[model samples]
Target: METRPLDVLNRGRDKRIVIILKNEKEITGKLQAFDIHLNMWLSDAEVSDSEVTKKYGKLLVRGDNIVCASPE
Candidate 1:
């Protein structure tokens, strides 16, 4: 059997996942939607970096800004 990156992501839908950004920021939330480009929409999002953590009711992240995204 084989698995693909998007497959993993699909399974993570509506689940908590961690997204790493190019700026080394981390965002964790329940994934709401995603596209082929990796653009994503998240709910109950928390963005964190070295200094602080911020919360968002909803978030849209560009595919270009993402380094990696994995199930948390």
Candidate 2:
């Protein structure tokens, strides 16, 4: 049997995931929620922009801005 993309993603729920944004920023966080559109909610997120890294307790990412995402 073949696994679908969402099935893989669903298995990653509540786990650490890294997301690359369109602007080239990278974010690593614990996956909280997601939808069919690929919109996501993350907890304890750390965003890395070049040499700068920032932290957020929670973050909401729009699907349109996501370049790639995978479990860490």
Candidate 3:
């Protein structure tokens, strides 16, 4: 069977995932929601980098700013 990216993303809902942004920032969280445009909402989000780590109860990421997403 052939599956599209969205199909994979849909399957990832409510699961832990890592989102990579255009700026090379990485955010890890539970997938809450997503749209055809790739706009996404993540719950219990966290950004971990060389400098520091930030946390959020919820996060909305614009589609244009997203580089890629994968299961955590």
Candidate 4:
């Protein structure tokens, strides 16, 4: 498997992860912070065009909202 930032997203803080959110939106950024609701705080996010349409930000993503992740 390809190790990218997203892969480590579920691992917790201080870890790198690339998050692929719902609506086929991919965000490649560090896991700066998160909450109990699975909402993430990211930095250096390389979001996809689809995400732009959804108005992505600090990323209030829910666990079920996530499609996949990688460690980059």
User: What is the C-alpha local distance difference test score of each model?
Assistant: 0.92, 0.91, 0.87, 0.62
Which candidate number maximizes lDDT?
1
**Candidate 4 residues 1-72, lDDT tens each?**
637544444565655677777877776666777654556777655667542633343554466777766655
C-alpha lDDT of candidate 2 relative to the true structure: 0.91
Which residue pairs in model 2 clash with each other? none
Model 4 CA deviation exceeding 4 Å by range: 1-12, 49-64
Error of 2 at 12 (Å): 0.4
lDDT of 1 by residue, 1-72 (tens): 447768778788899999999999999999999998999999999999999999999999998999898985
Q: How many backbone clashes does candidate 2 have?
A: 0
Q: Which candidate do you rate higher for TM-score, 1 or 2?
A: 1
- The better-scoring model by TM-score among 3 and 4 is 3
Worst 10 residues of 2 by lDDT: 1-10
lDDT per residue as tens, model 3, 1-72: 536768788788999999888888898999999999988899999987778989999999888888888975
Residue clash pairs of candidate 1:
none
- Backbone clash count for every predicted candidate, in the order shown: 0, 0, 0, 16
TM-score of each: 0.91, 0.91, 0.89, 0.54
